[model samples]
Target: MGKLLLFLSLLPVSGLAGEPVALSEKTYDPSLGVLIIQVNWGRTWKCGQFEHAQLQALTFTQLPLEGANSVVLELQTHSQIAAENTFLPYAYVVQPGEYQLTDFDVAVAKSKKEVIHLKGAKEDMAKAPQSAGTFTIQPGEIVYVGHFGLDCTEEPFLWRFYIEGRSEFESYIAGFRQKFPFVKEVPVQFKLFSTQRFGNPYALENPTVH
Candidate 1:
């Protein structure tokens, strides 16, 4: 009977091999004052034979300033269009605080001497760098959303800034679209937390690969 049963077990199994397993859920909590920068490439937009491609939504948080002071956000736009040619439109600056939204008119100010019109225009202009646009992040607050772009050129375009604050830095990234009109709609959140004592538990529990 045992030999007869072994002879009858020649049929194939039902399912195939090497099936994919479901991935687990993950959560990330970065250290306080840590700037998380994310960059993505977008669809290329063209102008005649020349191409005007753009880097989409390079997002990051400005680390909180230690002393009682303001921070400057700068965007550099390198262009193929010479200075002699009509100035090609490039970048703009945004200063986000606890209660207000200020937009700096980068188009108007071509030179360092030109005024930057904003709520705290005088203070912002005073701190404005000689080569680029400037906006002031008020004390006790964080900049939520900021954007600027450079024209197509062989050289790379760079945008950089600093965050100013003392104690706990608040994350103002919630509902950024309603706050800043120029920012394109996207799923992004910038959080400000203290990096001194405790570690980010969420990051430890769920690590990100790459």
Candidate 2:
């Protein structure tokens, strides 16, 4: 999908066939599958676009298409319009295949200071990366992949990304269904698992391609 845009190129590696992709409801076609998900920066995005996130999508081989990591090609941008739970919706167009969230970027402060969190960020550290649980996407359907949130509640604040559960689905999906009438007839699945905060969002690791 040439329309895909990769915002921040954090690292350099071998090239991939396709560029990263993230689409809006206006740009989505009825033929392709629609993946709708959301993320909360934990706090308000006072700094605006400075706080960035780059999601990569890899081929079935799971190899680093761009470099060491594939791309999210999902909703990496924050919505000026907030949804339920102060979350932002990301609508991604995906081909039929296995996809993974190998790496993602999140902000720790009010500024656009981003930290790259590799799935297995630091081998030595006991904390594992939050599992980007698996699921499938069928053509012309809308899939709700649950909500992901960043919470820095501690005194100094630790950036953690969590996969919120179904309790939130009803609230979010209910609101989403009303906003995008196009997806009203589409089938949806609520299979969001424990995409817990495990890996070191603050640390970086050497790139190791599959």
Candidate 3:
């Protein structure tokens, strides 16, 4: 059987000038047990005068094996940019027998036919043991995915999405349902850290600007 796909709507890059960016709306079909996330950056939107900007979409999937008590899934995505890309810091935890699914896609207005490709790590988690410490999840508990988006200087936008569920596997589904209830919410704290700039070789070489 093919893997289950979860669709997280294209979350717009907030804090852009006065123009409000509209993100793609997400839908989940409980009957099919499939979740769909899509985001549209719209056309002719300029990130900066000098920057070649475009809209990108990404999807991730998490799943648990039937016989195993633990669940893990390989993470990957397709983007609209070339060279390389980097994602913000994020973390997730599931029940003992639950699993997760994530997918990524990006769309740029520059080319109608070709889309930039966003790459994902082959491993189940984004952070290594040294970076991501051990996480504990209780049985029949559900915790949605936690993501942090940072800019060139590792300044957090303080945006977060949460999922609620009793079983670790069902947390994502629950979180999807909460989108309507938790509308127009922002993070309380913003922290600044230094990290490499995403998708830019120059930023990686010089960590000082991050």
Each candidate structure's count of clashing pairs: 3, 10, 34
Worst lDDT 10-window in candidate 2: 1-10
Models ranked on lDDT: 2, 3, 1
> What is the TM-score (0 to 1) of candidate 2?
0.48
For model 3, how does the per-residue alpha-carbon lDDT over 1-210 read when each residue is reduced to its tens digit? 012123333333332222112222332111112112222222223423212333343333233323343334222233333413323222222223223223233333334554443333325333432122122233322222333221212221112222122242243333443443332131111111111322211111221110
**Best candidate (score: lDDT):** 2
- Best of the two (2, 3) by TM-score: 2
Q: Rank the candidates by TM-score, best first.
A: 2, 3, 1
lDDT of 1 by residue, 65-159 (tens): 22243333322223322221221111122223311111222222223354222122334323332222322333222222222232333322333
| lDDT-best of 1 and 3 | 3
Clashes of 1: 3
Of candidates 3 and 2, the better by lDDT: 2
Model 3, residue 111: distance off in Å is 4.8
- Candidate 2: the clashing residue pairs are 13-67, 55-71, 55-72, 56-71, 56-72, 57-71, 57-72, 128-198, 128-199, 129-199
Candidate 1's C-alpha lDDT?
0.24
